[model samples]
Target: MNLSEFMNTEIVAGNTLWRITGLFGLLLVGFTAGKLLKFILSRRAEQLREPRPIIAATLGAIGRAAPFLAFALGLAAGTSLLVLNGASELVGTCVAIVVTLAISWTAICLVDAPKAWMTQRAGQTESKLDDMLAPIVSKSLIATIVVLTVVQIAQILSGKEITSILAGLGIGGLAFALAAQDTIKNLFGSMVLLADRPFEVGDRIVVDSTDGTVETVGMRSTRVRTLTGHLVTIPNGELANKSIENVTKRPHIRRIFNITITYDTPPAKVAEAKAILEEIMKDHEGMDPEFPPRVFFNEFQNSALNLFCIYWYHPALWWDYLALTERINMQILERFNEAGIDFAFPTQTVHLAGDPSRPLEVGVKGS
Candidate 1:
């Protein structure tokens, strides 16, 4: 309102209030342009058949900072409207730094976006190994980038070597490294499992006296659904070292048993029994024909003639094989009965030719 105050304050053609209002107008334009840019970029991203997150992310980052860069430019232009002689140069430098930093942040986003997207996608796979690896890779990438960023920031601020920054963190870093020892070892173990592929998810395996189908393989441990209906978690560190037997991986299962007949069974009848058994093995759908089943008179036991039989079941599933076995056994019994072949029982004959009257002075051990 006073003459001296008004005269000194008016650096541009307009009063201070008018200049301030123009500054705001320019900022408003910057804000509107940034929003328009963001919308167009995001809409175009949505049109892509498969979104490559890196592309979308880089554009998104630039769109977000466009307004800030415009605002800084406007502010730089407005610097002459003030009374400070040094303000223009300082504002220009600041604006340049801000633009550079914004672009740098966008680059970082470009690198980081794909990893995050990949981690998310890996979780959708049927294999449990992928699920375990995704998070570990994601977190490791994040941690490494963060540490490097901090060290760079330090080097920029203090003009020190990267080595100096590392030195300062030594004690704390040592403690953290010590604590993560087991975790690191387990991660390596999981990596070994992935590479070796001893067993996969849903495989029935026996390891360390535990029998089950593998439920999940994780970075730290593997979960198994045991035959007894319990879940057992074994650390990957131990699992990698154990001998794992993948039972389901075998081609076929073997069955060996004996069929008994009375000692008095005629040799001709015995030969017929063996022939019938071989036929049964051949007639079954699941029996492995290449390995031809065998039935032979092995030996005469305490009270019976023993027939040794060997056979195989293909497509080796436990329940399926067992049911097939039951059917084969019943069929054998039926066929033998029809042929008048007698199964064995314990029998003994006693000699009493000269002991009929002397039997009063003698006794049978098991009479």
Candidate 2:
């Protein structure tokens, strides 16, 4: 047989040899072009990253999805020139699915570029709102893309109209919503938290029995790293309704204490105790001028004299304040001891019935 005759020979699917060869040729050309484009874009993206990060990221994402996208397009084009006999619908459906997946893959990759850019920008700023918002936005968009892709694939498989499929989905969604009411509420609660701006990441907060730093806030839950090193995940719905004390927001830490002295101390000694406290506490470390330390001999108890002391420490750093408190306590101890001042303890005096200090008379009564 001559060349033309051999080329005209029909294949099993009614596709002639020449046509099959052309189909493969187109596919090979498409793949080669796609590979070349991917290489060029990848190199360009790498070179441009430092100067134009956003554009570079976009190019990189496109390059990563180029091969699959080109292959799917090539398959569609090559199949169009073939006679599939009884498999035309099957081939077309498969091509549609491939196209949908390829597009979805590209879109999903594209989402990463913007998300990374947003995250980087957020890092540069002081506000944490964007830091928490960036990931949520990316996930939401990716989810939307996946949902649409699934709907398209379903329509292709079931040969249904988009409107009818959506209607059915709406009914099913209502049932799903009813079953997952808590999840929906948590999502809305997340929205409320974002709007309220109550606390940011790394803020120390007290909610009911949980005292911790906010690690992350998500659509369903907020993660807290507790003081005891345990991670607690609280649903946003419940957190929204609960009372939260943001300890990080306080301007100062106030301390109230009592200095007790023995009642046997003379009036001069009592006055001297108050003066010593005033001298020790004056211009204390971390002290706020507006909320100065106070020393007052406020009360006389049954066995002791009570000196009420109060002070406010600024900047509110727990460890620093504790250090200052320790130093002040040591100073008080040293000063009081040097002045021959004694700290009071609980004590009692009793007199016996036949003691020299006290004599008691008892009358016996006959019943």
TM-score of each: 0.58, 0.85
Residue 57 of model 1, lDDT score: 57
- Pick by TM-score: which candidate is best? 2
lDDT of each: 0.74, 0.90
Overall local distance difference test of candidate 2: 0.90
Q: Write the per-residue lDDT of candidate 2 for residues 1-367, one digit (tens) a residue.
A: 9999999899866899988988898788878887887899899999988888888889988988888888888888999989987899999999999999999999998997888799779978999888778877887889899999999999999999999999999999999999999999999999999999788888999999999999998888999999999999999999999888999999999999999999889999999999999888899878878988999999988778999999889999999999989988999999999999999977776667877667887679889
Summing lDDT over every window of 10 consecutive residues in candidate 2, give the lowest-scoring window.
349-358
Reference-based lDDT, residue 361, model 1: 42
Candidate 2 has what TM-score? 0.85
* Top model number, lDDT: 2
**What lDDT score goes with residue 310 in model 2?**
90
Please give, for residues 245-276, the per-residue lDDT of candidate 1 as tens digits: 98868899999999999977888999999999
Q: How much is 109 displaced in model 1, in angstroms?
A: 11
Q: What range of 10 consecutive residues in model 1 has the weakest lDDT sum?
A: 103-112
